[model samples]
Target chain A: MRIKVKFHSLLRLYLGFGEMILELPDRQDITVRELIDELNLRVGKELKNKLLDGDEIKKGTMVLLNGKNILHLKKLDTVVQDGDVVVFFPPGGGG
Target chain B: MKSELSMFQRQIELLGTDCQSKIADTVILVAGIGGLGSVVAESLVRFGVQKIYIVDNGLIDAPDLNRQILYTYKDIGRPKVLVAKERLSSINPSCEIVPMDEKISESFELPNDVDGVADCLDNFADRFTLAELAWNKGIFLVHGGINGFWGQITSIVPNKSPKMKDLFAGVDEERQQVQVIMPTSGIVALLQSLEIVKLICGIEPNLIGKLLLIDLLNYDFDKIEV
Candidate 1:
């Protein structure tokens, strides 16, 4: 399955890349947590520390699956479909 | 007496009288007088947004001199909204400027006639408060934030877009001291002003239901659908 992941705001800077196309095992579905883990592994960055704390996304960071915030769905356990687009964005907290 | 159209002749010639009237008829509440608010309020005044209500209880600080254009070093320790009202009024004497020396909170009462809001507050807690207040009022809120070389902007319109609180659902309200270069705040605030202008002028703003991210470090700009 091919899943496209995008990074925006601070996450893009933290990950060192704006986008990545992940080719994972041909499973029917995978949770957003697994996708984040695989993405961190691919980038060799502990993105989880900056972006996630256990099942919850860290403060200031949001994980959107196909433009909808995953927190509104199933948090990290939300399933992702093939060809789905996920974005890791940390909205700026300052003015 | 100089006609209002003549004062905005340059812009009216381009956007036409219909757009000009819409801007004059709209009232915007700018919820901050710091970096983003400074530019947004100034821009709105210059754009002929005839009525503006600016709110902030912050006092000018030494650090603010770098980006808070409305206040100078001599104005440190003075209230931001008061200085902002003075500056904005000088720019457009005909424009009505109301200074509210207060912080946005659950108890803070938004002006009854406010038509839109500029979310230029320094922290997310107040941003959420101001956003929801505008939502309850069925008015649009243009949000802008800047840190370092990065910035983001979005517009939340009632019934037309998701709630800002929902979109930033996971955001913790803890305040942090954030760094912002002068230009980053200026750029973001100007865009926030433009978003409000477009919304007031009956033109579609690109930021509604979407986030526009700016990475001035790499000169990259991206818009992500929220």
Candidate 2:
């Protein structure tokens, strides 16, 4: 299975890349948490910390699975299917 | 004072008399009279909104002049709510400007008559609080945030779309002051005001159940459904 991942705002700056396609071994299911673990490996530790804090998604960072917020679903445990487009971006905090 | 029709002649031409009356009959709450709130309140006044409830506890500082257009150099050191009331009243004396010099917190109470809310708060915590208030009241909320060249606007209709807190879960409240460019703030603020007007006029808002992400630095505008 393959999923397209896109980064925005500071996440793009931290990762140094905007988008990528990750080929995961075909499986019955892959949750967003599992994908983040894979992403942490690719993007390294520094950026991983920016996205997560001890397994919790960092505050201000938004994770959208196929444009829907994963929090509205099952959060980090939300399932991601093949070809799903995942987006991670931090909505600016300042008014 | 200008004739009622003539006062909003330009917008009346665009929205028609019925829709303009809907806009005039609605009451909006604008939280935080700073970069985004200042402009959103002013636009509401200029658009002939009948009433606006503005909340803010900050005083106008010199640095705010870069984006808070409602205040002038003379307004520095004065309470922002008072200045915002004075300026918005001058823009449309007939429009009621109810200013509350207070901060939004868990206990903040929204007026029962408010038809919509504009979340112009600077931090995620306050924004989340405001969203909860809107959801509890079952009113529409238009949220806008900006930092430097990045900004986002989204309209949340309670029970119809994702909650603001759900979208921004785990996001830490900004501890330090964040950089905000004047133009970017103005653009996002106007978009929020536009959403409110569309809500009142029965027009489908652009960002309902979606987030409009803007990157002025790279000139990219993306709308992501949520």
Per-model chain A TM? 0.91, 0.89
* Steric collisions counted per model: 0, 4
| Superposition error at B4 for model 2 (Å) | 3.6
lDDT tens per residue, model 2, A5-27: 98888777666677899888866
lDDT of each: 0.87, 0.87
Task: Give the residue spans of candidate 2 off by over 4 A.
Answer: A23-29, A37-46, A71-77
- Best-fitting candidate, scored by TM-score: 1
User: In candidate 1, what are the lDDT values of residues B50-162, reduced to their tens digit?
Assistant: 99999989999999998998998889899988888888888888999999998888999888899999999888888888888899999999999887888889999998888
lDDT of 2: 0.87
Instruction: Report the error of model 1 at residue B70, Å.
Output: 0.8
Candidate 1 segments exceeding 4 Å error: B1-4
Q: Name the 10 consecutive residues with the lowest summed lDDT in model 1 chain B.
A: B1-10
Compute the lDDT of residue B4 as modeled in candidate 2: 66
